[model samples]
Target: MDALTSVTGDGQHIEPRTEFAPLAVMALTGGEPAGGQMVSFFVDDPEGTGTDFHGGSPVRVTTASDGTGTTDVPLLAGEAPGTVEVKVIADGAHTSFSLTVNGHPEGNSGA
Candidate 1:
């Protein structure tokens, strides 16, 4: 069976409308790298107050030699406090990254 998992940029706390770390996923089939595979990214913001893929959702990318796929673009927090969900799909396998857009950063008074 193939596998897809978020290797980074998951369960992070981000401030509203701010830039955070990059997201990446690994695609493996039978415990081996699934290179040259096409990985698709999607955004699930039910509150409509979260981020999206830079050019929009459903961004497609080909995995590298090490079975790694990354979002080459930037993903910022939305206009309000909410959770942003990024769903990664790879050859019928799936994984996800969740980020919370909390209000205000440390030492910021929202002034």
Candidate 2:
């Protein structure tokens, strides 16, 4: 399979400078799982924003023999809330998705 089938996150809003549950990426072949593959994760920050991948981006991860992988994307503290584009590539197939970051409310400590 050369196409990304699906991309999803564990939460809708991500807290800045925090490591949340990984975003899941799925690959498929003929509607079936394309397992045992190597995939790479990338983040596209056009404006040189404060988003940080924690040395995670541009990294390759092997699928769990089920055509599924996870990406750990983190933002720096004081980073503005906005949408970010994430690119995934595998075996000449590539796809992109947008992730939204939610701002922490004032006077509320992010615990």
Candidate 3:
């Protein structure tokens, strides 16, 4: 079966206006790493002008010989705190990640 599995940068937290760990994913087919595959990563805008993918959304990355596709640029958090969703898609399979901007005020997400 074709599938996508998150390799890193999932369920992580970052400080406001800071950089996050690069998100990574691997494509698997029949339970084997699928190298040279093109993976697309889409980031959700958490707080208006805050938080964003370093190179913008739907970043495309090519899997390496190890079948791991990692986002070359890091995700950026805005001045506010909130959670963002990142989706990865490849080979007709997809997966998602949740990143939270942790800080004071708990739920004080800016528009």
- lDDT against the true structure, each candidate: 0.85, 0.67, 0.83
What digit string (tens of lDDT, one per residue) describes model 1 on residues 1-111?
299988989999877877868889999989998899999888898877768767778888889999999888778778777887889998799999988889655666757
Residue pairs that clash (backbone atoms under 3 angstroms), model 1: none
Q: Residue by residue across 4-94, what tens digits does model 3's lDDT show?
A: 8898889988778888888888888788888989999988765653777776787899998778999997778887777888888887999
Candidate 2 residues 1-111, lDDT tens each?
756754676234577665544667888877778888788877776644456567646757777777898764453322666666667789888876666666658866857
RMSD of each: 3.3, 4.9, 3.8
Using TM-score as the measure, the top candidate is 1
Worst ten-residue run, lDDT, model 2? 71-80
Clash count, one per candidate: 0, 0, 1
> Residue 64 CA error for candidate 1 (Å)?
0.5
- The superposed Cα distance between candidate 2 and the true structure at residue 104, in angstroms, equals 6.1
- Candidate 3 global lDDT: 0.83
